[model samples]
Target: MAASWSELMLSKLVGRCNNFFQPGSSRAMCKPFMVGDQQVGWVWPGVEKHIQRFPDVFMVEDKQVSLCPSLQMYEERTARVQEVMVKLREEGEFIALKGWRDEMYEVFHQRSSPPVFRMERTATALLGVKQYGVHVNGYVEHPQKGPLMWIGRRAKNKSTYPGKLDQVTAGGFTAGLTAQEVLVKECAEEANIPQDIALTAQPAGAISYFYEDERGLFPEIQFVFDLKLPLDFQPVNTDGEVSEFYLWDMDKVKEQIAQPDFKPNCAMVVLDFLIRHGHIHPDQEPRYLQFLENLHKTLF
Candidate 1:
């Protein structure tokens, strides 16, 4: 087994994903995609034609790329792109939108008519665009031990990260609602937390990383939060997405993270929590700085 959480998990998550087409300077290389001089995304070298299938929206010339210059154009072109993604999903594309916020995510520099692609298909519409989500680490005041945390086991039927451990609450950033709004809503829906309690969740910070797979690139930013619960409160799973909940000692939580139990991305959220709360210190972990800095990366 690896000595640290970073080596066993975070490194593999970040290190194994460097195969994306790196959009270089004014000179495009490795499948460059330009949206008005901004390389907002990229595609693997041999995979450009799959993107080329949406000829009207994407222009690939000599492996260099360009997108529709106007929002109106993308609005007109999303249907065909979605059609392909849907077919791809049937062909085994692992797209998931379990707790999707029904708002339209703004796409491209022009801030177009907010593309109508399905939340799952949004990645397909643009291969390298980044998406955002919200994650919160909920804890309680223990008069004797100080603090303990609430954790969830994702439902086995979940399309992604099934049966894995997760933070108290998490949901993706949808087209509508501020992060706070989503946080409150998710707290109630996922954990049965009352609105009054949900409103107390504080904005801790954010963690960003890059991930690529058969579907495409996901350079994501997760806004993290910390909510302290009433001494007697225990989370009840209102949403079926979470199968069960547990209030575990910080030591137990850290132990589980070092295993393959927590959801992969959730592992980093937990690591961030440990560092911020002084549970994981530079004096204890050899590569604490590198691990912290690597989690917040700009992978273009």
Candidate 2:
């Protein structure tokens, strides 16, 4: 028998996710690079050349090159690292990445509830560092039509994923906010969701993946969420970050997702929603058991 579109969608999403970790030891590549007990950030083994390129900030050895241990003496060495990163940008080293956001992302040795230290957000991926992000899958249950999902098309002028499909609410986990705080704030800013409604979102499990592309290695964590909006409530794009809003029925959503319309990472968030809501059942998917196991599995 031929597989259903839903089946293919689920399988492809899982396979694409696993490919990130399958190339090398998934766990090996995602290992935290530390000094003594302190985990400064993630470092890929093969990135010694890149690290060596900046000798002052990165102390390069034969096999490993890490930030100087003395950098720990300061409150945050991100300013020093930012200097090197800025020089690289000036020399045309970084392409396709945006300018500095003036926002700092926490670098952790472990996935601490509150991360370890603040680093310039722009440089983390360039340095093969792991970072945290939150994705909330906004949805509504119709009395007769089952569940419909809220999707956003990103603003064309945005630097990353411009004009691509995104979740209802998604943003990087910055230095000062908790996961829940980010969820609520992004919901309001991106979708005009009220605090009471956004607070109703349930904490779904998370997904972890690492991929290396022309840009750099992105070791990412997406904290998932499931939110059910009231039947009459319509999502409004308030911040202008999103160009439009889409309310797709389950079947239409499956078909739309089968195409390449959605952003790469946001697809995983939707797939997780489908599985948890029983849209994709065990018998419907060949990789059902494997996908279940991998969803919450962490490289960290």
Candidate 3:
């Protein structure tokens, strides 16, 4: 006997939905779904609209089921996919989604956990492990020199990109902290900026960048933020995570970033913010020339 179409689809949906939840151990996290019998980690399921509106967002493989998004819809549908995740929690037959399973595990493990921010990790056998970090490119208006970007020269002793100019304040997001919480804590701990000052800064957005370290550990996501500081703000280094700080003129910063010293995607993200806000003048250099071209196309 063959499976009905709806039955097959439902099974696939359940499988993909279960993949979202996994257990976190002390050393590493456990992934829910297996890829060719090997567990894979968390994957962002595009946006909510595609999950609800597009038929192809869900798929099945070998009756053992594997799911992935259609390439055309992946970028535009991220938020939409996340929004409908709760629906799967309610309707799917996956053990992870069942409240009883989580409750039983909590009781058995003697740990209290929350739903939205649960920890998950990739399979242990993978050569490289990725971790998430937050970076803030802070800017303040200078009374005499216009807008200045805050930057830090990383310490030479650092394990990764050492002695290079980097974001003003950056740190790993520890357990039980939101991005906002991490940013505030990082600002104080790394740059000696007050928690109130960091908290008050507006969140521009996030950009994810990936890179690999010398040891084969992939520090995949640097979640970037643009923070506006007061004109009179002066930061002191509290923890020496940053060796030194400088307020660079926009042009100089852009020029320095274009060189090989700066981290690739991090520099580009800051340049994107500057170009979008018209701070980097079109007449300045080739970088701004491209920005102007993009702006013209965007406008007309």
On lDDT, the candidate that comes out on top is 2
Evaluated at residue 94, the lDDT of candidate 1 is 38
Best by TM-score: 2
TM-score of 2: 0.86
**Model 3: per-residue Cα lDDT over 187-269, one tens digit each:** 99778888878887666555432222112122244566778888877778887667888888887786666555664544655
After superposition, the stretches of candidate 1 with alpha carbons farther than 4 Å from their true spots are 1-6, 9-30, 45-47, 70-74, 77-104, 108-126
Which residue pairs in candidate 2 have backbone atoms (N, alpha carbon, C) closer than 3 angstroms, thus clashing? none
Q: Write the per-residue lDDT of candidate 1 for residues 18-99, one digit (tens) a residue.
A: 2232343211334656666666656655447565766666677885677655523454445554554555455543343223
Worst 10 residues of 1 by lDDT: 18-27
**TM-score: model 1 vs. ground truth:** 0.81
Better of 1 and 2 by lDDT: 2
Evaluation by TM-score, superior candidate among 1 and 2: 2
Lowest summed lDDT across 10 adjacent residues in model 2 is found at: 23-32
- Candidate 3's displacement at residue 114, Å, is 7.1
**Ranking, lDDT, top scorer first:** 2, 1, 3
The local lDDT score (0 to 100) that residue 111 gets in candidate 2 is: 69
Cα RMSD to native, each candidate? Answer: 4.6, 3.1, 17.4
